[model samples]
Structures are given as structure tokens and as C-alpha cells.
Target: MEVDGNKFLNTGLLLVATILVAKLISAFIVPKSRKRLPPVVNGWPLIGGLPRFLKGPIFMLREEYPKLGSVFTVKLFHKNITFFIGPEVSAHFFKASESDLSQQEVYQFNVPTFGPGVVFDVDYSIRQEQFRFFTEALRVNKLKGYVNQMVVETEDYFSKWGSSGEVDLKYELEHLIILTASRCLLGREVRDKLFDDVSALFHDLDNGMLPISVLFPYLPIPAHKRRDKARQRLAEIFANIIASRKSANKSEDDMLQCFIDSKYKDGRPTTEAEVTGLLIAALFAGQHTSSITSTWTGAYLLCNKQYLSAVQEEQKNLMEKHGERVDHDILAEMDVLYRCIKEALRLHPPLIMLLRSSHSDFNVTTREGKEYDIPKGHIVATSPAFANRLPHIFKDPDRYDPDRFAVGREEDKVAGAFSYISFGGGRHGCLGEPFAYLQIKAIWTHLLRNFELELVSPFPEIDWNAMVVGVKGKVMVRYKRKELCVKQ
Candidate 1:
């Protein structure tokens, strides 16, 4: 067939032009269509990174951080847990609204422990109100009364210690913290009459949060069974206490009272169940964290003689100024001891990982300017244990240097808002932070002023196996009673 060469060439040129336009359009649209997920930790097919993560979460994160950068994901069986490792990329994780990053799904394991209609079991709005109850109960004014109880508990507990002896500081602090918590939070009734029973029940509840329980909370496990029984017994006990208080028309200066008196924004009174649940949640939140922090503080202080001496010097100066009285205001003045406790918490945050369930896709930009889009349905997490020790944010991150938080240094503030998130940060930041600090300070201050302490055992290792990571084994310390020289 005779063809016009000019016509055929023109047609071919037109086809090429159309193809090029399509290519150009694709170049712009394709990039926008594909979301860039954070680097994934390679694992076996199906099982994914569960084994390595189960082996050691912090260790796995440390190993992967250099290779994967700060933002990375580990697929655990069916779920994806994306970790935001440092403050540089953690602001969004801390600040995102509940709609974006929901805690309700990821922390359902806490439902059984905290009881129904509270915390992770409740919706975000209700949870916020419940949290407000905690906030009100732990306010500075409420903490003043709590601190007085803390002081009394500390003085009473330590007075039993011999003039000169060796003891497991860890055991002592754990026991003492529960006593203080019971007095200040669980009410004077539980503290005085039912201490041992309530304490054992709490132990059962805490032990129920195994790794498997996170995924299968209702599994037919012995620990879960014990936890359920303990929770029931606790409810009955508290219900009786609540009823007795109501019948007698009595009120007490304690967290139990605070929760009992707590009213919703609409003015509805809290139910017996709600009050009990709030109290359980409060004790659960503060008990382990405070004890673990207290133990770590003592361990670190004893290990670092210079810092220990600094705290001792601070205690001496305070005694001279305040004449042996240590209250909330006095504990607030304990900047040296506070720094030491804070440094320890930075190194060993009891709740290693803070988590949320991503309900919508979001993007995060790291300090290095690398950006990644996190897709929905992933468990978003930040490790305070890892983040608090980032070399870029904290100098000699491994070393127990309390002065890093001092006025002139303030390394924690060097990075940004979430740099020092041992107690977490932003909207979901720990409401119990001030209370935790004061409780630790009260214990340590009394010890510093009344006893000369020395580390007798080797430094304790991190008990990574613990649900609330803490010092492994006993923290043995030698102590001798010392007379305080208060100015007349």
C-alpha cells in the first residue's frame, strides 16, 4: 500500500509526545501515591521480627538503630510495632491527638488489670476525664498531704534499720514505696488494717502482664486467673471501705477520698466501681514506677560517689536551713537529689516503651531531615529507656551523671521538648511525675540526712525480663545512723 511518509512520521511523533506526557504525569503522581514507610527490621517469613524483639526489645532497638536510623518498624507476627527512637522524631508520637494515635487498642492488656470502664478500656474522652481525676488527686496541694505521709512512712520504716548494717536497698525501697502509696493513695484503712493482703493482691495484678498477654489478654492463664481473683477481692475490700466512709459521713485526706469525691464535668458522681478502678489504676501507675525509680536512684547514687556526695552535701545544707523538717516544699528544694533521681530514671525508665495505635497515616521528620510516613494500623511506640540515652541529646549517655540536668548544662533541654521523656511528654505525659519525684526525694532525703549509705553489692543490671524494667537482683547497701547537726 502506498503511504504518505510525511503523514506516517507525523503520526509516530504524536504517539511519542503522548507517551512522554504520560511519563511526566506519572513522575509527579506516583511519588504522591506511594507512602514511604519507616525502615523495616527484616525477619523470617510470617513470624517477622518477633523472636529478636522478644529476646530483648532495647537490645534489638540498639542493634537496629545504627542500621535502620531512628524510625523503624518490627513486624511481630501479625502486628507492626514502629519505634520512634529519639526525641528528634518523637514529638509527633508524644503530641498526636487520640484520633491520630490511640492508646486504647495497643494497651487493651491493661484493661483486665485496671478494670473495665477506666484507662485503656474506656474511650479517649472518658479516659481524659479519668486522667483528670488522677491529675486533681496528684496536684501540688494534694501532694503536700501525700508528702507528709511519705515523710512519716519513711521515718517510721527506716527507724527500724539497725545503727550499722547491710540490707537490700531494693527490697526496702519497694516495701517502703508500697507503704507510702497505701497511706497516701489506698487510704489509711488499707494501709493500717489490710496492708499485706492488698499488697499481695497488687503483686498478682502486676504479674499478669506477660508479653503474650498483650496480644491475648483473655487467654486461660494461671496468672490471669490470679489477677482476676485479686481484682475481685480488691473491689470488694474497697467497696466496703467506700460504704463505711459514706455511712459514717467521714472524709480523709487521701487519693481514695479524692476519687470518691471526683465528679464528671456533667456533675455525675463516680460509681463504686469507678472509684475502685481509679484507685487501682493510680496504685498501678505509681507503685512500680516509683519503686523502680527509687531503687535505680539509690543504685546510681551509690555507684557514683561524687554524685552521692553532692546529694549528701545538699541534704546537709537543707538540714541547716530547714532544721530537720522535710515537707513538700522542702522536697521541692532538693534539686540535687532530684537531678540524681531524674538521671537514674533517664537511664532506666520502668515502663520502657510508650505505645499508641495509629488510626490515621502521619509523617515524621527526624533531626537529620529524613522523613517517613507512618501508615495506619501500626503500633507506634517510643522507648524512653532508649530515647533518654541518645548520644546526640545526652553527653556520655551511659554514664550516671546527674549534673547533666544542672542549670548551666541542661543536656535534656538541648534537643527539644521530648528529649527527656522518662515520665513521657506532651498531652499524655505522666500526671504522676511530680508525685513520683517528691516520693523518691522524701525517701532519699531522709536516708541522706539520717544514714551514711555505701554500696555493698556490685552494680545491679537492668531486669529487662520485668514488665516494668528494674534493677535485677538485690541492691545491697551498708548504712550507719548519723546524727543530723541542725542549726539551733
Candidate 2:
């Protein structure tokens, strides 16, 4: 028995050795290069450029994009990622027709949180269909109700803060945005029942995007296990909701309800896994980005009192015009407010880079006629952070100028179609732009109108280590009750 066991162990070790050797060989050998791909900072030998890469969201692509010039490559783990910066090349990621660039393969890393068959995992066609359904369900008519919910929730949140001392806008917005998105996407019942689980899932999932384990997720890492558990908890919650909703023969007109009623291209109802996946996708996208933006917007308002005052004046004007109730039309008509939000997204976009995977070998020619034939399996990324800040696109790119988006402004038409890509670009762009706009605008409008924020610090420092950009110190501000405040 001992001899047989020893022989079996030896064979298993031999097989493992063979697989590792093959993988190492495959990683090292690049096919005959037609063009020289950009040189990268040296990193760990087997991991390539992973050692030098930023440990935060988009793995520090935000900082690297500027210094590395227009096109650069970095070997992460065993995989090589080529980042395309500026509006022109970045547009190729969003606008190329019949291209092999697909978001599914690259973004599938998110599946541990978003689940299989989710928007991030699916192709453009399915993503569009799911988005269309969400749009129909959460239409402009439906937005007023969501705004009302936001008002109520904001009121509750403020009551708890109660003319606060120091509050973590990060935690505050996380709770508020999740609560608000839950109300808008799942309605009150589901949001109430599953709120804690949803929050926990998002918290865990956000941690999962760390660059460390993303390169080797199955390696028995603590973050990996937590990520899996988070997904399991979220999936369990969604699964129970799906089963109950189906069993009760009831459906509400929220995003989840839309998924439940949806039929695939084959004209059959979506599977439970698909439904849960879609729900998770909607919640993840809807919640986090909006939360980050709202938090930043609030912080910027506190820091820039003039902009804050303008926002308050705009909100007051809208309230007066619409009799103190926030309507979709009222929110939409706040042109200056929209511009401020656009400027905020310009200054601090929720997502730093647009990620895609090359499905086949492709040639790219810069306008200057510099050409590179990129082979398949190379991860491709585009930066809206860079595109939105391109000097040619915006005259004073770094300035937070809302006038850039103001009505009939030259800045609106002064530059590239691909320049402003906060919601991303082309077919794979964010499906919830309108929904997100409404949610954020409503929250800010309510708060700005109802409160006065005094910033203690001159500026808040942004922590860019994770998927979402957050502040190191909670945005420290004193919120004076609106009822007691005089016009400044």
C-alpha cells in the first residue's frame, strides 16, 4: 500500500510540474511581433509588471495613463494589458465597428460578485436588451417616485446625522445610495428585507477588486474567500427573492421585476441564475458609481462654497418653479446643476478606465500612422479620465468649469465626440446614465436646498487605491439646518 501511494504521489507531482512548465513557457513566448509594443516598467519575473503596478482600482491605471503616454503595455500576472489613452485611441475601444474588442472576457473577473450571465459577462447585444428593459421600467415617469423616496431617505439620514460633527461621507453615501438604489430597483419590500445582505455583498465585492488577488484569485487568499462568501450571500438573497416572487405570482415594476418578466433572445423567460445575475449587475453598477459621485459632489460643494451656493440657488429656483416637489422634468430642467455634475464627473470619474479583451489579433493605426498589430488575449483598456482631460478636447481640462456643459456653450461642441465619456462610450456604455443622473441630481438638490455645509478642511484628499475613489478623511462639514439658514 505504501509503495502504491508513493508512486501515485510522484505521478501527480510530475503532472503538476509539467502543467506549470507549459504555462511558464506559454507566458514567456510572444509570437513574431510585426511592431514593437511599448516598453513597460519591469516587475516580478513570472508576474511581469505586477510589482510596479498600482495596488488600487484599475490597478493605478489612473496615475500611469498620463506618464506612459498614449499607448503603453504592462504585464500583469502572466497576462499582458495594453492601455490606450487620449480621446482618439480611447474612442477605438468604444466606437470601433466589427472589432474583436469585447468587454465580457476582461470584465468576467467581476463574475465572483456580479455572478455568471450578468451584464459584465454578457455580450453587447444582451447588455443592450437588459438595459432597455431597465430603462422602460425606471422611466422618467417612474423617477418622481424614486425622487420622493430619496427625499424621505435623505431626511432620515440627515435626522440621524443631526447637524453632524464629523461623518464619513463614504459610509453615509454607501448607505444612502444602496438604500436609494434598492428603493428604485427592488422597491421597498425587497430593499427592506435584503438591505443588510445587499450592503454586505457590495462591501465584500468592492474589496474583491484589489489588484493582488485578481491576478491569482483561486490561490486560497483571504480576500478571495471573502469575495466568494460575499457572492454566495448576495446570490442567496437574490435566489430567495426570485423563488418567492415566482411562487407568489407577483412582480413589481422595478429593475428586478423587469428581469423576472424578461425573455431571452430565444423568447423564453430568463433562468433564475440569469435573473439573479442581472439583478446583481444592476445593483452593483447603480449603487457604487453613484455613491462615489454623490459623495464627491457633496465634498466638492463643501470645499467650493461658490459652486455650493450656485447649486443651492439652482435648487431653490427649481423648487420654486415646481412647488417644492422634485419631479423628473424639474430635475432635468436644472441645466446648471447638470453641468456641475458633468464637471464633477470630469474631475473625478467613478471609473478610471474602460476595460476590454481582444478576441482576435487586430491592427491599430494611430492618426500619425504609427501601427501595432496586437495579438489576441492581450487585455485592452481605455481611460475616460484621460479622455475627459484631453487638452484638445477641453481648453482648460483641469478646471472644474460647469460652463463647459452649459446651454449653447462653445465648450459643448468645441471638441471630440469621444472626449466626454464619463458614462463611457458606444454600445457598451453605461445603460443607467439617465437613471443615475436623476438619482444623484435629486439627492444633491434636496441636500443643497435643505442644508448649508461648511467645510472644515480646505480640500479633501482622494484615496485612489480601490475600484472607487474615496476620501481619506470623511468630508468634514457642518450641516446647518436649511430652515434656520439665511441666504448667504
Candidate 3:
């Protein structure tokens, strides 16, 4: 009995020791696991704080800024995203080599839709070749013709409003912009009856960027299914368009034609699938960003009458100076209107975060004597939505002031390359930027000349789940025909 009691006591002691050791190890490791974060971090520990972030990415960012400081860490979906926000950090995104940090790692989820052969999926070498071809086709000379087409398309779209009682501007504008982009960038025939289905697919695929996919990329979830469907539909659409272009012997001027004519460094022609993916990438790149920005553009104008009048006056002078024609040269001279657009972008950039992942280990220094070692797989993001609103970058950061971008101001000198990243930066910078600018300018010029506009919705409340910074409810607007009491 004594021996058995002694054995039982030994076993109990061993169990107690094991539990104590585990408690000690956890206490030591948990705090150490949270050393100074890499350049940035999103939220607190296991709780993730995703609800806080989902409230409004931009708003959450604003709330976290003072609490977390310029650089901090947050966990979302068991993943760490470090945000190196502010103008200085934002500048690094433009200047940093694509080799040191890259977009592909962070945006890999898009591959299911964009395809493996797409420029967005390929290595820097292939992207270089593709971007060169894209730039040539979308350069100033090529854009002039497309800009004219965009203006005509805008007129037709607005005509649907018909001195309107009320209309959902966001929905109508997205359709208009995407259709015009498909026609001008892809090809006219590609913009036919098929786009209604294509647009629906794109919308569904865009909704797939949830925590589920971030956690399990291969799962047969709704997001994955929608992504797959969009990919197949897009591929089919592009295949038909390419076949039509070949059969008709169409001129190779549009972006689709550029893909058809491009040759890789080995002098091999791009495959049909390659051409299709490239076209889809271009279409996706152009449509949503412009639509979101334009919607905000209208919203901002409605809220601020003074700014709206200034834009209208500038448009009037531009039309009179250039005879109501939109060319690249005329676009250059619409300086005040451009400033207004810039101000709107500053206030509500289409994206809250410009995500990039470290391709290799990197080091960045904060204002303090602290340095962070960013690991190869670490996700890095910058919020132009935040950077553009920085008090140091803009004098009155929250105020919607176009004069901030007027001649000779520090805001005016906000480096077109990096500091102002409404279009993003680096080698991966948006190829459709120039064309997008011209399209927005043309739309504004045409509309401001013809209609008196007012907002019917209490200004848009942010929908953070949106691929772009989008609004939850529809933005309704009332448009009255301008009395020709004075011709613009």
C-alpha cells in the first residue's frame, strides 16, 4: 500500500511539472513572438480586429493611426499585414525595386481570374514586355481617338437620365464606363450584347476577396466558384472577339490588336489565351477605378457648390478655347478641372491600401532609431487614402480644396510619380492612367456643360468590402437641363 501510494504521488508530481513547464514556455514565447512588428501591422492578436477594419478601411486606418503610430501590425485571417503608411513610406513603393518587393505575392488570389499567363501573374521580365506593348498602344496619340469615343459614349449614357427624376448614378456610370473601355481598349465588337453577362461575372468575381479565400485558396467556397465562373466567361468572350478580329482583318490599333501583334523576346507570337488574359486585365484595370472616382467626383461637386462652379467655369473656358473638342492637347489645358479631380482623388482614392509583399528580406527605418526587418513573405501596404490625407502632405488634409493643387504649391508638387498614388506607382503602375484621366475629363466637361446636377443621397457611406472604396446604398442624383440662358 505504501509503495503504491508513493508511485501515485510521483505520477501526480510529473503531471504538475509538465503543466508548469508549458505555462512558463507560453508566457515567455507569446510576448517574444510580438517583438517590434515588421515595417507595419494591421491589428491586435488572435482577435484580429477585422470587425474594426471592416467598419471602414479608411476610417479604421484613421482610428488606428494615432493609437498604433505610423507603423504597427495587425492580424487578419491568421495573416499579418504591415502597413508602412505616410508620404515617405508611400514614396518607397514607387522607388523600391520590383525585385525587393512585389505585388504578385499579395495579389496572387487574383490569378484564378486573371489566369497564369496574364501580365499580372507573370514575372517582371514578361511584365516589362507586356507593359511596353500596352504603353505604346495607349500613348498620347492613340488616346486622342479613344478620348473622343469616350465623350460620345458619356453623352449617350447621360441622355438615359433624361432631365432625370432620380437614377442610381453608380450603376449607370459603371455600365457606361465599362462598355466604353471594352469598345476602345478591347475592340468595338467585343462590346456587344455579351457585356451584360460579362459585367455580372466581373462583379461576382470581385466579391471573392474575403477572409475565406485568404485562409483557404483551394476551398470550394462561393467566392472560389464565382471566381472560376468569371474566368471561364471572360476567356470565352475574349476568344470569340479574337477570332472575329482575325476573320475580319481588322486594323491592329486597339489593345486587343496590340496583343495580337506582340512578339515575345524569343520572337514567338503571343498565344490566344495570352491575348485574352491581357485584354481582360486591361478591361478590369480601367473600368472600376474610373467609375468609383467619377461617382465621388459627382458627389463632391454636389456637396461643394463653390468647387462645382469653378469646375464649370474651367470647362466653359476649355470648350471655348478648344471648340468643344476633346483632344490630348485640350486635356492638358483643362488645368483647373484637373485640379478639382486631383482634390477628389486625394479625399477618396479608389483603394484604401496599395498591397505589396516582400520578395526578399528588406529593412526600413522609422523616424525613431528603430529598424524593422521585413521577411520575404511579409505583406506590405500603403494607404494613399491615408497618405493623401496626411497633414504634412496637404495643409488642410481633411478639407476638399482644389486650390491645394494650384500652381507652385507644395501640394502641386506632390510628386506625380509616388506621393500622389491615386493611380498607384512603380513598374506596376496603372497603364490606363492617361486614358482614364482623359475619359474623366471628357465626361465632366460634357456633363457640366449640359446639365445642372445635385445630390439626392445623403453623401455616400463607405462600404469597405467593395473591391474599390465603394458606397453601400445607391447614390441618386437629380439632373436638370441647363437653361441656354448662357451657352458654355
Sort by lDDT, best first: what order? 1, 3, 2
Winning model by lDDT: 1
Residues 1-488 of candidate 1: C-alpha lDDT, one tens digit per residue: 24788888989999999999999988876675678889999999999998898898988988999998999999988899999988778888888999998888878888898898888877888888989999899888999999999999988898788779999998999999999999999999999999999999999988888988988999989999999999999999999999999999999999999999999999998988989998998888888999999999988888888988898888878877887787889888988888898889988999988999999999999778889999889999999988888898899999888899999899988777899988888988889899899989988888887788899889999898888888899999999888642211
TM-score of each: 0.92, 0.83, 0.86
lDDT of 3 at 269: 85
Give the clash count for each candidate: 0, 1, 7
What's the CA error at residue 331 for candidate 3, in Å?
A: 2.3
Q: Report the C-alpha displacement of residue 189, candidate 1, in angstroms.
A: 0.6
Please list the residue runs of candidate 2 whose C-alpha ends up more than 4 Å from where it truly belongs after superposition: 1-48, 55-68, 97-99, 120-132, 161-166, 365-369, 408-412, 484-488
lDDT of all the models against the reference?
0.89, 0.71, 0.74
Candidate 3: lDDT of 169? 77
* TM-score ranking, high to low: 1, 3, 2
The lDDT, on a scale of 0 to 1, for candidate 2 is: 0.71
Candidate 1 ranges with C-alpha deviation above 4 Å: 1-33, 483-488
Instruction: Give the range of the ten consecutive residues with the poorest summed lDDT in model 2.
Output: 479-488
Question: Candidate 3 residues 231-319, lDDT tens each?
Answer: 78778887887787779888754678878888988898888888877776777777778888788788888899998888888877866
Clashes of 3: 7
Off by over 4 Å in 3: 1-60, 76-78, 207-211, 368-370, 412-417, 483-488
Instruction: Give residue 198's lDDT in candidate 1 (0 to 100).
Output: 94
